[model samples]
Target: MSEAALPSRPASSLATPLLILGAVLALAPFTSAAVALLGGAAIALVFGNPFQGQTRTWTHRLLPLAVVGLGAGMDLRTVARAGLHGIGITAMSLAVVILLGLWLARVLKVDRDAGLLIAVGTAICGGSAIAAVAPVMRARAHQVSVALATVFLLNAVALILFPPIGHYFHLGQSPFGLWAALAIHDTSSVVGAGLAYGKQALEVATTVKLARALWIVPVTMGIGMIHARNNKEVAADAPPVKKPWFIAGFLAMAALVTWVPALHGAGHLVALAANRALVLTLFLIGAGLSREAIRTVGIRPFLQGLILWLIVASLGLTLVKTGILTVG
Candidate 1:
């Protein structure tokens, strides 16, 4: 169904107010990350998101800041250790997910760009990966939207389901964090699930996910060069690669805390505040999931994403459980 078919009055009148309320609650100490996401989603589905554009813009801006801020509480040593430890698995998983995703897209007869975007998103860091690769592939707006919506929908599910599943299986904090980092789509969702699981999980997941996210640079550049080779005109007009600079910001913050022991207390406070901002970020992300976005996802793209995600998640879980993917 087209967006025009949806009722407009509630979106025009109530959406802003509901969105504001949800954002306020998300920042409040009483609400958890999952609750904030659910509340924002409920508001959007019921009233539609009048501020959908604004919400997306804010989410993009705030998430990085929150991630960097959380880095203040981390030890540089731990960050380095986690990143280094996960390198082998991260490389292997990215290769597997990308190849498997492309195969699925071709078999499913899904649009090539959309399928590739979904695969890249799942294989790397969800929306960030898609955002980087979309410009390289020169995907159409609708194709990008379909891929993003599929990933977004799955992110919400992973955030809610992962903690419970971790508990059911009695997964340890480090293992669960590693699993969440490898399995979940978005960094925000990975961090949210980690937070829900435990402190150690949050730390491990954030470090590993950010390390995984760095793959976007090489991957996007590779795709851009390939696309350029295939189409000279498109190559001439290809956009410059957008690096994930926030990762550097995060590392800087971690280094600052690690080198200057005097800032430890202050850094802890900053990290705590950043965690709250992350919850607020998730709420805004949820608010962007309007009915129209859901409608735009369609079925085939969603199926491809779902199948790819399941395969990755299952394999990651097995590897982590078997101690093959442990963070040393």
Candidate 2:
């Protein structure tokens, strides 16, 4: 059997204890999202993650639930309004980033599938987007891995830097949230940065990012159709596209809270618990950022991802700061 088929075991005697300690720190009430990520990364880099498979599985399961839980604290009207307002900008940005990323990939001589995966990840929802599109494009394993690693590295940086940058620029809560939602590659990082900023920012960022994530469906379908048209084998062999059901769950939670004023007190508690879960989810994400993953992100692909990200982030910031992008 392959290593994946084997049961999870600690890499070393210290791995379990260290992981336990990291989990405790991540869930601690005072721990910030950035700090949780840093701590987990530190442990993974130093001792390695023995439970890599388990970590990936849990992170996948927990992140969506946490996002759904956060919805309990949101008003449906606000979420709807933010989603509507962001759709146009999100679509435009996605198109620009996808085109720019592809051009940069060609200029850098990166692998076509890898370049496309990186571009899709950057344009949409990071690893989730990459994961959604990869099989349809018949992306190689290394291509998907490199794309994920590049996006993960940038996500770590964005989570840490965005809050300080927002404060430095004296950005309003909603503006900062809008910028984070637009610029950050992953929903986790966007929510983390928004959380670090303030309540209003968190609400705005989460709502807008979730809204932006909805594009994954159409984009994946479009890519699949294009690939199928060029190569019939692609349509025949491609795996079914997975829907982001968490978004609907999130909306349901928001609606429940919105319609029932009596649930507000309980919703607040659930939201708080969800926030803690998100921090832990980040810790798991960081722990998966092993040194091997970093080394796998070779120079050219990393450069392509980095350049594309910088362009998106800078443009997003300028628009938000100049009042060209605002979230109600």
Candidate 3:
């Protein structure tokens, strides 16, 4: 009986080891921002591909959900601050990115839908934006995969280059933070850029990043409505999800943060966990892109990212410099 039970124990025992591995990878440096690259690399090398027959299993189903669990920390402070203004910003940014990028793509002879997807993703919250708007626009999976790749590459580049650029310009903490939040692709990128600078910069970057994230909802809704009117025929299966679940989760999390601030937990632990989740998630998304998608997207999306980065920087600087938004 003991011998027979020993065989069953192997499967049970694997969980501990996997968890330990995850923990170590997420903290290889013990105390540094590079831990993200470390952990993300470990996951990518180990369980990266869905077709590898690992993530397809019942056990691996929790991985995407774990990524979703990052939503639990959304908190209300982010929501209350965003409110009506956030809704407006989301509308404006999405409209701007979609209209401008799509027009450019058409002129360049690129796929209009793919171009629009890339622009929205770059301008808003990165992958989430692409993931949300892709359905309404009838984007191919590869298009999304490509859009993410383009944004992810730029994000990694921004993480490395933006800090020194910020320093060279002698941007103050608040101005630098806003610039990073606006220019960078996502929260993790913003945090990485901010941390590379200082504490005050980190706080400022996060505030602006969250502000940017609030734009996803209206943007998706707006895009969806436009699609409904414009597309004469769309597959019944297309635009599968009614709305972006993450946006809903994001909003709910913000509400929780405001109404149930008690649940935010201690500052250090929750903040640390949230930051870890943000970094790991972003890196994983970047690594998930297919090679074919990269070949297809070419320089159109990259050029769009560069253009948006410039716009975000100039706009963000003006907003801060002119006291459009208050930062302490």
Candidate 4:
């Protein structure tokens, strides 16, 4: 939808649209993000920005809470196995994507900060990775916003494309899960793709993606240290970011599910709640993907992200096809 057609509305008038959005999210959990994305854009086209006051609350606060909530349904043993199995692929893909993205950014004459954000987002978890590293890199607000937009755009595409591609290849749950985990940037897309594939795919993808996300702390700290040594002026200006404590919540929840025998009977209920929470999270993510955010993203950053993702996706599929990156 075009931006010009959207008219600004007061907060009071948003009640109807918000209720409509909630109902849609509940009814169509699987396609909530895609729906919210198109529906949000349409909302913008018709009613102006639908996320003025609540965007931050939804994206920053609610989303992570939902992810942590998901952990309750996961077992520590299964998560460990998934993490160990995915290490080789995750490490290899991350290194290759970062190096390739850096070279591509230089070739395309993109800004280094924006390039790094895109590379990190492509290599690890999408917006979360970028958000964690941005403060350490002292990235400008516009750069962070643009990089996030770029990742979100690709995530939307992945949600639609990866499932069909996996099915066309007749990939088993294990390989398809690995493919989705490695190729998709964000947890939402990974989960979305996996859900479209099968139940087993969702289980495997969730564990692998969460394991991959743990790299954010070390990666951000290492980058910060490098910047400090090479460019003291930039390092001095960089803001310190708190370590992501949400990860601990996720791990702890998994441990609880695994070790606490008493909670075993509650598995179904926890899983149901978690799935609903994820639907809500995706809906919020889509609603926050405003046209203004997309407008801030430059052509070069978007190109860099697309190219990096293509390279990673190709390499991941090849490894799976070759048995080099087999799923347990």
Best by TM-score: 1
Per-residue error for 31 in candidate 2, Å, reads: 0.8
Checking candidate 4 for backbone clashes, the offending pairs are none
- TM-scores of the models, in the given order? 0.94, 0.94, 0.70, 0.87
Q: How accurate is candidate 4 locally (lDDT)?
A: 0.75
Per-residue lDDT tens digits for candidate 4, residues 256-324, read 878988887686577667666666566556656555666667698999999889988888888876778
Ranking by TM-score: 1, 2, 4, 3
What tens-digit string does per-residue lDDT give for candidate 2 at 1-328?
Answer: 2123334424667777998898988999999999999988888888878888789989999999999999999999998997787566678878888999999999999988789999999998898898889877876566777888899999999999999999999999999999998899999999999999999999999998898889999899888777777674443333345568889999999999999999999999999999999999999998887767777888999999999999989988998999988886
Model 1: per-residue Cα lDDT at residue 83: 76
Candidate 2 residue pairs in backbone clash: none
For residue 311, what is the lDDT in candidate 4?
82
- Candidate 4 lDDT score at position 83: 75
Candidate 1: worst 10 consecutive residues by lDDT?
1-10
Task: In angstroms, give how far residue 206 of model 1 lies from its true place.
Answer: 0.3
Using alpha carbons, what is the TM-score of model 4? Answer: 0.87
Tens-place lDDT per residue, model 3, 1-328, is 1111212211233433553455445433243444454444344444443322232232223223432344454444543453444455655765776677776667666566667777787778776677677777776655665576677677767777777777777778877887787777765677667866876787667656666676777777788788888764764434355333544554555455556757667434555565565544434443343343345557866676667666766676677667675542
